[model samples]
Target: MDHAELTTEQVLNRDIPWETYMTTKLITGTCLQLLRRYDKRSESYRSQLLDDDGPAYVQVFVGILRDIFKEETVEYVLALIDEMLTANPKRARLFHDSSLVDKDIYEPFLRLLWKSNWFIQAKSCKILALIVSARPKPQDGSAANGEASNSKRKITTIGDVLKGLVEWLCAQLKKPSHPSRGIPTAINCLATLLKEPVVRSSFVQLDGVKLLVPLISPASTQQSIQLLYETCLCIWLLSYYEPAIEYLATSRALPRLIEVVKSSTKEKVVRVVVLTLRNLLSKGTFGAQMVDLGLPQIVQSLKAQAWSDEDLLEGLNQLEEGLKDNIKKLSSFDKYKQEVLLGHLDWSPMHKDPIFWRENITNFEENDFQILRVLITILDTSSDPRALAVACFDISQFVQQHPAGRVIVTDLKAKERVMKLMDHESAEVTKNALLCIQRLFLGAKYASFLQA
Candidate 1:
């Protein structure tokens, strides 16, 4: 019985009575230890588990967990759940099977997931998503009423799960630390849950639309940006659900999305925002929301900007293609002017329309110039090559207008930095800087100081 002499096979196959050894202490320490060690060396364990000649040890070891959860002991059940989640994939795969899932175990499983330490909570949420997704659908019997009744029951179950998950999800997202882990895990869980039609129906039923504002809000961390995007993607998928599109339109998400599109400095964030915009706008309900949020100006800027960053630009183009039909919504905002002026301006696909000058530019009497000044200040001091490039591009577009250029030239100190950027290594920077230089000299006539 010496530990070093015992192989995993011997340990697994050597069964002690569950009643004797599966008490609270044994469940927390010894059982968890086995699950951890097996999972830690998962590849090796899996190699053995999946092999045709593999020993029967894994099945026996897994049976311990099965027996533990069934022991009518809450302590043992919670500990077993933790062990399965923290255990390596090789060991965890044993628990992944649907045989372990049941209505009685479902709610407790969720409670354990929601309350676990942050590191393991991610895996816990994923497990819950899988369990809900795999729940059996009711039979499609010959009785017409049977199908309807089954559908209603399925919908009801999905609603309960969605509400529970969302309630837990909101609390998790509010945590200040480790959004990098929490957000993506939540997003993946949401994505997985969407696989079932009943779940999709429940997603709409559960006020998921209202949940999106916080997901995409400025209060969110940089870590949550992609997570927010993925949630937006979830909303995009749910766009087809009954009344969901209308719900999203009424919710604050679309305006927030437009703000992210207009204001985000990160290229990846912008790419995601635009793509989500495209997806939402493709549908009539959400498309109107985009228009109300000033979709025309944003789309115009995006189309004109060169966005030479291939990966980022490619993402933006994909978003554009997704919303290609919705481009019509942008027409009345001065389609002719933006096309005639910016048809040739090479800029990031993430930029807004330049033609707002003629129509809305003159009417900026109520607009906040403080933000514009702050943007100029940021562009002057920023060292990030990508950000500097975007700043230069935006400033140049703003200055292209005859009156605006003259006004900006008097106030915006762009010449000093454009010269410094002559030494920049990034093509996006050089390209954007060169455009700024061209505009500075061409219309504003600041070339003398730039040359000096």
Candidate 2:
């Protein structure tokens, strides 16, 4: 007996209940048949089936079909499509035509999952995110016709619905699970939905930045981290439109961003951090404000990172463009310089005076020694106390490292200055002088003289 031959009443009155039939693969297969029939220009089958109700019925039937198709017979699948297209063209058009209107019919199931249990809700969010993200984007300079007319310029109600759903999803993610699935799906959904400015703004308004901050680390799964990257990108967009900077700076985002920037793994996360910083600093004078609020820590981190000088150079270059006259403040390392340099022993600046003094202490007889001697002659002509201190320290460390270079350090004037710096206010210079003193005693064969 043909399954379609059974009347709705007969079907409802059968040994199985309507709920069972509605859920079974038979009904799902039947609906897909009806939908495909409608796709093929068969109006009569669609009318017969769709006459049961409006969009809500169509939605319920579609949802049921989604539930049942996995178990249905192949023959039933073919017949249902044939019936639906024969019955109603408009209803068939929903599937045959891949457009925003078609997506409308399928989106409700995702929305419905908001009220479902954990696993179902997570799956629904993933599916919905896929649908939303996969929707056709508008083209440039295309005719403002067809689906464009249906797709309004304003933000859709869909974004609001999605935002609320994601908020609920994120709340559930606070729990530990048998398998951690909810967060990844929810983040994917959030990323997809956030493609819209309105959706992105909604997330920002709902403290989404704070929620996303915790998820930015590479410790999270790759997909989860990618979702985080997308979320950060979304936040980057929001940074310009809303008070996102205020939120990012105040919330956990700033620290997480700094951590990612400093992390040895995850350069992509670091790239996003750079972008987020760029956005935060976009307001010109506001960029300088970051210097006080943990910016120093971030800079300190960059200084210690493997690419310290390169990253610092880029960052300082950015700051210089933004601050113009006040850029010199960044180069001042009076407090952190010694520590940073100790950690980065290979760091050698291009400044001729420091470089010349460094090379002189290493090998004054080398080719560059003439240039170094000339620089030393010029330095001897100046009496700037700071200049004298730096030149003395540079030569002192070089000579200490290479015993042959102590010839340059034995100058009485340089010795007096080094002794003065031993009591210098800066602990860094004083530490260096103490170090040089030990080297001076060791190199001079004056061990007993030092004891005296």
Candidate 3:
């Protein structure tokens, strides 16, 4: 009810020790209490506030939970959290400092995550995300000394809850309905859980990789690009562990990963995929296995990009120009914004790894000319300019680098695409396209074709 502007310092200044929230009644009870007070304002709000001596944040969180529990007002609750978390992630992290890991609320809330309503599922995932990603402060500890300090007991309780959460999340992905909606919400929460090393281990223990890897194949945006991108990132996070990496070594994930990387025009998906490959290549044995499976060529193709900024490629700009009209007519503006925010992956460390790129590129025959066809089509139709530009660079490099490159390029009719691209608006696209055509012309075998 109090709409006063609480500054960052004020919001963070916890009025009660975080432990008070651990009491079962604090969340649901206080929420219901607060809602009743709001509805029946005949009584003084100050008198009601004075009656409950709990911290301001308790009321704040209780208020948050109360609104989310309501079927109608849940969207507003999520939007407020999104605003707070975006303006200052620490604001939400501050709220997360409270203990809400109770199976009572957590389990039921998680069940709602698989429901058909988008707001219900999204709000549920956001709550789970807060729980998993928030790092507890030292004060959040000593208060729980009686129970939480008992290290072994604490581990048992936390581990059991994590196991259940992980299990339910895997099930949500397999659910037949809500492919475009409910599943993405659940997938986002699963990806958040992967932030913790301990949680990541539990995910693998529950056969999480088996459930996730199949979703990566060829389905980037049936619902939205966020689902596919987050799924890839979660798998990338899992790859850091020996057990998950070992599973990927033997599983069908590699070929599927290859296909996604080669064809996906989604930026975040492409970026995280590089991280995934780096994780695999870091392991010497797995690196060798992947090379044997023909991953090196896939990595090499993306590596050969000519444009400095992949987002600005000429062909991709034209593609999006064509797509923008349909996007506006078919969906809301919010949908496009959601795609941008969700697809944004943090890849700073990935680029810093010299060994990752060094190990990924090997001098060998990429005998599959089908790769040329894929790149040629990608160069022409991809909405991400970087993808289009990269396709151009890849086709040029494939023709120039491999011994049989010319034969592959000539057979694929790649020269025609490159020539059309020469007149493209982006200088980078024109540059890469011309470079590709030049490679074709260099060979005497294609010299007669150039004349035509």
Q: In model 2, what lDDT does residue 259 have? A: 59
lDDT of 3 by residue, 1-452 (tens): 21122222333332332233334344555455554443324335533453453234333543555433543344444444444455445444443323532212334444555556655555556765664455453466522111243233323234555666676676666672344554776688777888777678877877777887777776644565677788888888888888888777777887777678778776667777766766565464554444444444454456566434453244334332433333344322222222222222122332224353233223223344434555677755666655555567655655644666777677777788778888888876777777678777786345324321
Clashing pairs in 3: 310-386
Candidate scoring better on lDDT of 2 and 3:
3
Error of 3 at 47 (Å): 21
Over 1-452, each residue of candidate 1 has an lDDT whose tens digit, in order, gives: 43213233433343344435545444445455454444335455645543432223333343443344432232333333444434543443332233333213344445545543453345446655654554445452221111123232222234555567765665555552253466566666776566556656665666656765667754256556667567756765665575766787677778777877776666656665665565565666665445444566576677677675675566566655544445454544333223222232233343455455445444222334433453456556666676667666656655664465646654556677676786788988888778877777676455324321
Instruction: Order the numbered candidates by lDDT, best leading.
Output: 3, 1, 2
lDDT of each: 0.52, 0.48, 0.54
Better of 1 and 3 by TM-score: 3
> What's each prediction's TM-score?
0.48, 0.48, 0.49
Candidate 3 minimal-lDDT segment of 10 residues = 336-345
The sequence of per-residue lDDT tens digits that candidate 2 reaches over residues 227-298 is 667656655565666565667666666556555665525555555566566666755444544442334445
TM-score ranking of the models: 3, 2, 1
Which stretches of candidate 1 lie above 4 Å from their native place?
1-108, 114-123, 130-167, 170-188, 218-222, 265-268, 285-297, 300-452
- Mark the regions of model 2 whose C-alpha exceeds 4 Å error after superposition: 1-107, 136-156, 173-179, 217-231, 284-286, 289-452
